[model samples]
Target: MSEDVLSQGEIDALLSAISSGEMDADELKEQKQEERKVRDYDFKRALRFSKDQIRGLTRIHENFARLLTSFFAGQLRSFSEVSVASVDQVPYEEFVRSMPQRTVLNIFSVEPLEGRIMYEVNPNIAYAILDRTLGGEGKSSNKVDSLTEIESRIMSRLFEKAFESLEEAWGSLVEIDLTLEEFEVNPQFIQMVSPNETVVIVSLNAQIGETSGMMNICIPHMVLEPIISKLSVHYWMQKEKTKSSPEDAEHLSKSLNNVDVEAKVLLGESGVSIEEFLKLNQEDVIMLNQSIEEPLVMHINNEPKFYVQPGKQKRHMAVQILGETRGEEE
Candidate 1:
């Protein structure tokens, strides 16, 4: 064997050459294409969400804005105005299709392959917000000016805040990320509803009057599915919580103990003339002279409780207790 050893660079070159054979250029290309296809399909399908989910998410944003407005009401020379810009639908693939224009400039799209709710920001609105947040330190006040680095950073922070507000208000159930996508002015976006596709578009714009720009919130349809399902489940749960079966609604009664009390029983034989009762009004007594062996009716809590006879409990009034009182036969 030769005592001479291969140089590090030569050995590296040899290893590279050997590995290159295992990955054919054409086969690698095909594999990459397959992966892209799978990813694209997933993106398209994952872009949808239900209507209730959109409302829930919007509520989150509203609550977040309210908190911010309250916190910085004084130092905040600027305030944001929010609005729903557009709601529309497109084929999942069509929405994600790449455009062929713009030769020199790179027009790469960051949109997911699924259909999306495209949100736009009024640059001026963003500037106003950013100026108040990141503005005090040598920031431009130009309404039409594109976002500066500081402005972008401030906007990023605000967006993150908005996302968090959404989660907190909605119970941390969804994940959301912002992406810049290629937008086209499509007439379909203006229609009131899209039932065929079952796509819901919700746009929330936050604008500062000082700056003419705004922030756009685009929620895809897929993000709302869980919310919708959850709402339905909640509604059903509420109904179930209040529901009761006939057997479960049956009422039972418990017997009450007897209490002795004396009552004067007026039998049919005891009679007083109307003339005699009227003539002897003051200090006159109409008495029912009955036998001492007669049982007297007893009352408890102002109701007829039972039948009992007079008895002695030292000096207190008492009665011989009878069986349970009849309560209209159940």
Candidate 2:
């Protein structure tokens, strides 16, 4: 076929026009809109946790209560009454102090640091609960005006326990042992930040016999990113393991190799009355009367292997390989 060719000048003119913004206006607008969408892309924020992770956290919380309950068995009416309101992913510096007019107690906050998760613990009631549950650890109290030191110790221990649980649940996926710094009456205006740039908030709402309030534990997002990723990977691995198990994989390969082979076996005889048999004591032959020449039924892994006449293998019962059957009788 003869080629339809363009001259060098023609190609040069076309290139010059394209470089000089000669494209159709509508096409340019469409392309620009697509690019703009990509630039403006931002995922909506929400709370999420794997079932195992959530369960781990919940068990930790329960254990925390148990420890406290054992510490103050009769002092407090109920020592374990905190509920996790939410575990959310949030932007740094977004949390602010509660409104000045709002007389809220037990507000807590935390900011990420280079090697620590700093916590801001506030209010008297929350600290009181912590103190009662934590008990005294060789440190005597003198009824001080502020429980700053006591609150710090209690919160530090609680967060440390939580970190330990996280580490145990996720193994190397989560790095624990970061310092847990705590304070009392820290103003919300002061910013606590993390080097990792992201963190998780486990907000606990304390419902103590009608006196309700909330507290928070902020954990670095970087500390949990690896955990979340590993959870996803572990889930997929479990699914694959289940799919590729020895029995299941063998069955699948067998199905692919021979579609005509059936894996089920059928009983030749149905249920009959056992009481109808003659009741003879010694040397009585209550025979089944099955033919010796009949091929013996064989099974493999609880499925039919083959049917063959009974044979002897060094005085042990054995079977000879016969034609593969699916309990079909002609």
Candidate 3:
């Protein structure tokens, strides 16, 4: 605390400056007040996530963007692109106020987590998706104020299917089962979190064909608080490293063992003039270049793998593996 106490020389210099009119007394008082104001903190707008956590959120959502791009491309049967625009933290009330009056607000719950999150789509993109799904040239109906019963069901089903991609994207960070709980057009009607609750907003820019708009995801701090530590670059890196364990390799080998592969034995190769081939009669004999004792090459998935001898087993013809095929012969 010695640094906090003023020295005699410093006190004398301050008094001399004040007496000489070098510094105004009122100005000094106001400067101290301004410094105090600068130090004031607002709990309502608290930052719950660190920079590393925000970067992890960005990386996760970037992957979600890619998955959404492919999903929309296939579902709409049009060119689609999705990319991360920004990730920010703000009060829940501010996020709600920033939304347009009429938009697609999907409230979904992540199972094994306590609270719900919002997936909001801009009116333009939502209408574009609806128009495309209904067999029109992908276009947005800007004047849409409400969804009809049919339209609501269609969109609900469409987004529910799209959530599969969301599930897959978050699988690396956490296993979540997303169930669409509610759908609303008016933001005022929904209050999943407190007004001043801290929430992270992930904005995504999406274009389906010629229509493009923003998609925002609102996740409250309370919802993420439980697993907040997992939302870090270090955790993601560790998770990725764990995926390559011996158990995973064994599981992969077992999965591959069940896969079917085509294997065909090449009997021989013979060439003849087109005219001679066309003029050939029934029971016509064309001698092949391969000799009887020569082993036939066996091709697996169209690549020569081994040499085998042709023979019959019971009622079916089969080939006896002789040895591996020489690369030079191939």
lDDT scores of the candidates, listed in order: 0.46, 0.49, 0.89
Which of candidates 1 and 3 reaches a greater TM-score?
3
Candidate 3: 10-residue stretch with minimal lDDT: 31-40
Q: Model 3, range 75-112, lDDT digits (tens) per residue?
A: 88999999999999999999999999888989999988
Q: What is the per-residue lDDT of model 1 for residues 214-268, given as tens digits with 9 covering 90 to 100?
A: 3444344554444455444455456458756665554321221244445542231
Clashes of each: 14, 6, 0
> Sort by TM-score, best first: what order?
3, 2, 1
Model 1: number of backbone collisions? 14
Q: What is the C-alpha lDDT profile of model 2 across 45-83, one tens digit per residue?
A: 334556566555554445544443343334453544555
Better of 1 and 3 by lDDT: 3
Clashes of 2: 6
Instruction: Please give the lDDT score at residue 227 for candidate 3.
Output: 83
Q: Give the CA lDDT, 0 to 100, for residue 21 in model 3.
A: 99
